[model samples]
Target: MRIVHLADLHLGFRAYHRLTDRGINRREADVFAAFREALDRTAALQPDAVLVAGDVFHVPRPSNYALVQSQAELLRFRQKCAAPVVMIAGNHESVRSADNRCILELLTAVPGVQVVTENPEAVTLANGQVRVVGLPHNSLSRLNTIDLRPDPQVPYNVLMLHGTVDSSRINDYGGYDVPADLLELPWDYVACGHYHTYTHLGRHAYYAGAIERTSNNIWQEATEAKGFVLFDLVSHQAHFQTLHKPRPTLDLPTVDAFGKDVAALNQELAANVAAADITDKLVRQKILNLPKSQQARLDARQIRQWQTQAVHYLLDARPPTATLSEAIAPDIAASQGLTATVAEYLRQRELPKDLDRLHFVERGLAYLAQTEES
Candidate 1:
């Protein structure tokens, strides 16, 4: 039996403040496009079953557009393929409250689509030809307590779940750590999600990875191939299928700004930016060991203009440790007013470029003021 394993669609994930021609968030549109392409390819593959291990959405409560787009795609898949599509909730779409239903449960309305949201459950499909045990995302307390075992009676037993494996190279993203012993279970294959990078734990277990880049670790993830896995039950072999070409992302080499004046630093930066091809790419420039005084002297307007050269440009300037500590000491020592303190804190915080720092600081200060008054 042929089975396609895919995960971490992360539909509606938005970033970089870029808007499409239709005014939708560009990253969101890109994510949706990637999923759509995957579905199209899956339809052509015509596998006996499709396994979506977890993280169908970027958040539990997605935008109406995202919901509609996802529903439509699943319906399209249902119409095209005769195989059953089994899905489970990952941390992103898992709810903490029992009162709230997981968004994944809504997909059950689509024919041939089965969803597991609350707990671990075993589902048999294709007239007992395949038996899949699904463990959906739940609280860490529940994950640790749940029992997982393979059915010895089934000829093809697949274990599907979403979580990090102990000592895996992928980041956990605050999800439960699935013990490596679970992968060692006597199952034919184990399909996993939650880690955005594709990984093979052994001959039997695999993480399909996100179809599109979805985190700040894009620089690192870029080095790894991103896509889904096609597992043949009869042969016990898996093939990775690359679905989309990721948007170009460049992490420029770090610059040692020690002992350089602002003019010299700016010149160096300008030369690097010009020499490196950043056109229509997301780029990060790191200026290391620069003093606050020197950083202050740099032309902010000129640096800001670099954003125009690339699709998105981030200038990450690391002030000398002594300079940073000295800058923070006065604020804590003097106990600067709430607004000033909040502004300082926001300035030091690492935020996505899509967010407006000035606006965020204003809102934070306003909230703090209201709390003080109350």
Candidate 2:
């Protein structure tokens, strides 16, 4: 069986406040473009099945544009391909309210598509030649209650879910630490999501990753490959398929501004900008250890002009050591840090009584450090 494993489409996600002539957010448009491209290319391949691990939408309630585009594109996909598609509700779309239905459930109206919202289900497809076990984000919480064994009769047993697993490199975190045993299952293929970077967990397990960069952490994922995984069950090979013209989010090399004055800083910043193809890209340049005094004198007019060059530009001029706190603005930034602020926010927000907030934040923070700059 040939399958296209895709995840974290994150439709309706917006960032950097960029907009197109049509007034659609540029990042949102980029995500939509990726979905269209992935579907179009998947059709060309004519895979037997498509596995969308999770996070199909950035949030539970997507915008009208997202809903309309999703319906239209999904219908378009059905028209071009006959493969069965299985999707689940990712954390982004998983709500605490039991009264509210998952957004993914609406996609079930489309023929040849299966949506798993709150629980785990095993769907046998392709004339019973394959078994797809779908564990949505909420279902992950009840892992012990569910059956993890694969169907012995099925030729191919595939596990599709959203969340993170405990790995050697689990420190740079994002999601709850799924027991490593989850990946130890004997499924022919295990498809995952949540983390934006495409990851290979085991011989048959993989995170197809977001088709395009989706969150504030796009800079960290700048170097990692983004695309869906095309797994050939027969050959036991998972091929990474690249998307065409994914919007560039580049993290340019940092320029040391330790002792440089405003004049020297301008020259340094100008050189870095000129060296890269930042046009229409989301770019960031950090001049580490810049004096607090020099920061105020930066030529705003020149910087504003540079900002216009990229879709969005950020010049992080970190202040030098002189304070009681070594941390630089740690709240949501690296100086004070992303973890504490996010943890504090979580404490303020409502959570399930059974949920362990401390553990939840720590595990995700492990992978996030690598993916996000905080």
Best by TM-score: 2
TM-scores of the candidates in the order shown:
0.81, 0.84
Q: Tell how far residue 1 is off in model 1, in angstroms.
A: 1.3
Per-residue lDDT of model 2, residues 168-279, tens digit only: 5331244555778878878899988877777888789887878898755677888777789999988889899998857878898877665467798888888888888888
243: Cα error in model 2, Å: 0.9
1-374 per-residue lDDT for model 1 (tens digits)? 98999998888798888788999987888888888889888999999899998889999999999999899999997888888999999999899986999998888888999998887888898889899998887843476677778778888999998888755556547578787888898889999988888888887999888988886577776456677999999899999998765666788876767656778888888888888888877788878767666778888888777887777888888865534343344746477765676567567654457999888878888898899899
In model 1, which regions exceed 4 Å deviation? 143-145, 168-172, 299-302, 322-374
Q: Rate the local accuracy (lDDT) of all candidates.
A: 0.82, 0.81
Model 2 quality (TM-score)? 0.84
Which residue runs of candidate 2 sit more than 4 Å off their true CA positions?
167-174, 322-374
Pull out the clashing pairs in model 1.
none
